[model samples]
Target: MSDLLARHRAVMPNWLALYYQDPIEIVSGKGNRVVDAAGKSYLDFFAGILTNMIGYDVAEVREAVERQLATGVVHTSTVYLLRGQIELAEKIARLSGIPDAKVFFTNSGTEANETALLLATYARKSDQVLAMRQSYHGRSFGAISVTSNRSWKNNSLSPLNVHFLHGADRHLTQFKGLSDAGYIAACVDDLRHVLATAVAGDVAALIAEPIQGVGGFTMAPDGLFAAYQEVLAAEGILFISDEVQTGWGRTGSAFFGIQNHGVTPDMMTFAKGLGNGFAVGGVVARGDLMDAPHAVGLATFGGNPIAMAAANATLDFVLSHDLQANAARTGAIILDGLRAAAPRFPIVGDVRGKGLMFAIELVDPETGAPAPALAARYMEETRSLGLLAGKGGLYGHAMRMAPPLTLTEDEAREGLAILVTALENIS
Candidate 1:
């Protein structure tokens, strides 16, 4: 191990995972690529875990931060009214698609989900929440409580009583063999059964990721959440869409992943790409839920001027460039290429995802069992070949790729070539 790695282990928590067997320190980045401390460049398909939406060192975001820095007043608690915060809030509210929507900023997606949970519980007067199985929220206690992935769930105790539901991972699920309509019907029936028999009281809310991020970019069939929404609404249960990984046009077909399901969530949490690598996240909801808590509440450094500026600039860049359309175009090419190559590689059990957020699930060729070791080997091979991808899933058998929305056809094809080569050389 390098000296920095040794020091990192000494100082940081052992649970914080890092990629690569010989982890390289990424010192700088430009466009879609990053340079390590050893000056090795890699095409950053992970994009800082999908946080750098527009790409590294984006000029607009940098200038926005610089302009805010010029003001010399970066940190202002939520007590004071700040122009940048107000402007950004207005932008988010308009784009949120909720009537009379209000926004509350946080420093990260975990905090955003935390705030959402508080609102859901307080509004509905219940501590019982429903979460999807094979889902990942965040690392914080409250976030982890709802997380269904065993590897990410560090503890069993939780403030809220969370019931795990099906429908997140279609391929690895019992609904795998069913047709699209059959799958949706079965999942809906299961949800109805859970609510009827299991939940003791009125359920507070149903929180779900439109696309399971840390669960390896797994997505449920279309209209699955819409089906759940109908059931939840009948029981007065709030719908909370955790858009941390699928928000801001990353999914291509829709501005928010939940939109693809054809239902408007009562509350939505966003982070990761919103600030373009800056620490910014927030919850957007109707006015009633926003004011549900009667007591005083505030996030000390949540809506700081610098973070708001970065987010506003990032949103502007995303819109002006029509990156959502770009994502749809480039993502289709990459997805088609991968699907075409999957037949040649028997280890690839599935190729799935929308837009730039895609994954390839590795499985044992003969038995069709989850092949996590093969996935790990493929990751290491890709790293050595100057490509960076992400891994996740309950079995750690899925290779995740979520490049910047600005990915060109050439870059997408290049990365695809490397990925194919990595798979070919896996044996």
Candidate 2:
């Protein structure tokens, strides 16, 4: 393990952080559990950073990939006609709920978002974009420019003129005390104010995550985006929903997180869970906007046969097993359990999220200030207890848990028990 760590540090970029004080190399995974190189089995609550939507080593997905391998054709790009890519694109376009929708495949969420941004700018004929504060899009330069989280935003240089808006993080906003409806109204008003003062003309688009993933699962009030959509429509500003983490029924109540806000965006970007750990990401947009790009655009590895096969199989398994319903039911159980445990753990300042995506924000008990150290200790302790969860927040003080959508009641209870014990130990 020491040798591996030394080699990793020597070869990999320093910014690529690994988990745990002693990082454990994961060897294999089945269902909701994974075995580390040390042969210790752990209940994987993070689900490979929420990429394994159904579960690990799903036979259906495995068989699909195996069948594709037997065909001996995998690298056919978008330049060639690939049946799997077409089928997956058709499935996604139909599921997108945008009228006359079209789908474009990419290799990752970051690229998908970049494609959306490019389409938006070209269609709207403007480079000014609006993004929510304390939100994250991706790691690329274009993505980072729109991302408002200071920790993730490495530099100020950007290609687009980006403006950060309020209402993404209610806990840190001035409208925290307002009721839901009042809060939405205040945010909309602030958005209007920003448009008048910041934007010079018609903005390209407003890109947002229904639930801020890296921002600790923070969510705006219900119908908040819908209200913003109404305003954007008046100005011909496009609305882009960054559904990378919130897509594919992980949010429990809906197939897409933006559905929770009762709004259908002009464009939506998805990745992470779609291919069930395989590299597949895409953008779904209206036909007119999708065809707006004049020059030819193509991705080298986009729409590969293997990725499409995996995504097709993963989507099939998710729908056939009704994992969305499972996510809703099990998510409520975990959410309630965490909320109930919050009072007992003084370090827990807030618990917020939807479906399987939830977070526990840590705080100093007396001052109520973010306690990043305590959060780190909690994460380490949880891992030691045979469970693997994730941590995220603007201040790095949130304990994020996004188990597989197929998590059983038994697994949920066991994870809750372990988390409760971890909190007790921390206290």
Against the reference, the lDDT scores of all candidates come to: 0.91, 0.92
Task: Report the Cα lDDT for residue 216, model 2.
Answer: 87
Instruction: Tell me the number of clashing residue pairs for each predicted model.
Output: 0, 0
lDDT for residue 422 in candidate 2, whole number 0-100: 93
lDDT of 2: 0.92
CA lDDT of 189 in candidate 1?
Answer: 94
lDDT, candidate 1, 287-398, per-residue tens: 8999879899988989999999999999999999999999998899889999999999889998998999999999999999999999999999999999999998779999
Candidate 1 off by > 4 Å: none
- Evaluated against the true structure, the overall lDDT of model 1 is 0.91
True lDDT of residue 313, candidate 2: 98
List, residue by residue over 1-427, the lDDT tens digit for candidate 2.
9999999999999999899899999999999999999999999999888898888999999999999999999787888888998899899999889999999999999999999999999998899999999899999999999999999988999989999888766776576678889889988999999998988987999999999999888889889999999999999999999999999999889999999999999999999999999999999999999987779888779889999999999998888888888988888888899998798877899988888898989999998999999999999999999999999999999999899988999998898899889999999
